[model samples]
Target: MSLLTALEDGVAVLTLNRPEVHNAFDDALIAALTRAYESAIADPAVRAILLAANGASFCSGGDLNWMRRMAGYSHDENLADAEKLGRLMQIIDTAPKPTLARVHGSAFAGAIGLIACSDIAVAVPEAEFAVTEVRIGLIPAVISPYLVRAMGVRQARRYFLTAERFSAEAARTLGLIHEVVPAADLDTAIARHLKALKAASPAALKATKALVAAVDQPLSEAVIADTARRIADQRASADGREGLSAFLEKRKPNWGQA
Candidate 1:
């Protein structure tokens, strides 16, 4: 299997299994990831989602053979392939549960999109990043929106055009990742985030994610009203009441304690 999935302690971990290829993804791997995300989103037991890879490098982007095959494909065929990749990115970006990426070694080309789509990302200090599609006569089209959202248009412009590699610290400066820890502490950092997520109400987390998305648009009277309604809805929820009561009572809510 190109992807390994496990549900443990309310976290659904999706591991890229092709270490030999630096976890580079092809059509099949893309399909596998899309299915994994869909399943995790629908599974009630899954409170969080983690994307990790078993490899020297987190991901080196598209598999070389996959690109070679695309060279022989007609325009329509290429479009279909690109669409599948796009869908995978969309699924991760829009997941209701909190999503995290554990990045290491290198995240290049499309791999950067996976990180961008994730709600949070943590990388080792030695990890590298690049948007090198332009170097190979291609544009980072499908992943452009997520990349731009993660690093803003100004930084994306420079990297997309220059195809220059940047350090993990640089990626954090651009807001592509939240933390740059030592390789030995990578799992520790992931555990801390998972612990924090476990302490929150699952439904509230989902609602909060939706709230963020809703407010991303231009603020209007409608948008403001929508925000008001969202908070009101959550306030009326069972978890909301429990959370408040627990806070007043100086005890943990029904959810796990951090």
Candidate 2:
């Protein structure tokens, strides 16, 4: 269980278990995470996915050896390797279920991508974050989409250029972390968020997320019409109808029930 995954009461916990290496991403780590995410997305019992890492720190970003291997490759080969990491980020970003990143310690470089991809993130107050790519003469390009979107252009400008390490409190101020808790109570804190997520309808949650992201995309008649149709279809679905009914009936929605 190097990449531990468990679906309990509608929450899929995806724990990065390679504490021995600071949970850095080598080929094995990427493959394990991709598999766990795919499983979480496919499991109907899972309403949300939580990403976490064990050990004193969270992910240390790319493994140094992994970088050294990439450093020897041609530009095309390097891009290919980067794409693999990008794909993992995309899978987490567009996961049909909601995602949360629970960071207990430092999250650096590509590790920030993980937090950025999560729909919600809660980090321990002592956790640190940095975009350390520039410190090693590399650009933080691959993670630009999630990073820029998470921190916005202004904040990305500061971090990407300076490569400065910042605290979790600073990340929250920049709108990255939804909340912060002491390490002593991180589990309790994450559980509180998951409890709220559990109360939501899975399909409705997915539909709502889609709506939120798409509703403001460059407005065109086709975009508006397509989105309207998409929402209308979901509103009439089995889960959708049940969700509305459950609210009126004052009962939990049928999630995790066969």
Candidate 3:
């Protein structure tokens, strides 16, 4: 299988298994990833989704063979192919459960979209990132929305146009990832985040994810009203009441029990 899916202690782990090619995006891998992500998101037992790869490089972007095949594709064929990749990115971006990327080595071209779509991304200090579509006489069209959202329009414009490789530190500075840890401590970092996430009420986490997306737009009367309604709805939820009672009673809340 090009992708491996496993559920471990509430985290749905999706591992890119194509180490030989640095887990490049072939059509099969793309389809497998899309299905895995969809499955993870829809599984009620899954509290978080983790994207990882077993290789020296995370993902080097489009597979050469796939690109070669695409070279001879008609306009409609290419459009369909791009849509599949775009849908995969969209699923990760809008997952109700928390989504994280565990990155190492190099992440180029389309791989950047996977990282950008994640709610939290942790990369090794040696990890590298690039938007290299322009270098190949193509644009980073499908992943543009997520990339722009993650890194901001200014940084996106520069990287998209220049297609320059950037270090993990630079990626963090640009908001492409949340943290840069040494390779040796990558798993530890992931565990720490998972632990924190597990402590939160699942319903609250989902609601909060939705809240962030809702408020990411320009503030307005509708935005303010939506925020007020969300808070009110949360307060009235069973988990919300339990959370408050647990806090007052000096005990941990039963997160997913409600």
lDDT of 1: 0.83
Model 3: CA > 4 A from native: 218-258
Report residue 129 deviation for candidate 2 (angstroms): 0.5
Candidate 1 weakest ten by summed lDDT = 218-227
The local lDDT score (0 to 100) that residue 210 gets in candidate 3 is: 88
- Candidate 2 global TM-score: 0.81
Better of 1 and 2 by lDDT: 1
Q: Write the per-residue lDDT of candidate 2 for residues 99-193, one digit (tens) a residue.
A: 99999777998899889888999898899999976444456665766787778899999998999999999999988788988888888988898
Per-prediction TM-score = 0.84, 0.81, 0.83
Give all candidates' CA lDDT scores.
0.83, 0.76, 0.82
Order of quality (lDDT): 1, 3, 2
Worst ten-residue run, lDDT, model 3?
218-227
Backbone clash pairs for candidate 2 read: none
Model 1, range 1-258, lDDT digits (tens) per residue? 899999988999999999999999999999999999999999999999999999799999988677656655554566567767877877888899999999999899889999999998999999999997655445677777778877889999999999999999999999999999999999999999999999999889999988998887522334333433443343334554455455445676674222
Where does model 1 exceed 4 Å of error? 218-258
Error of 1 at 177 (Å): 0.6
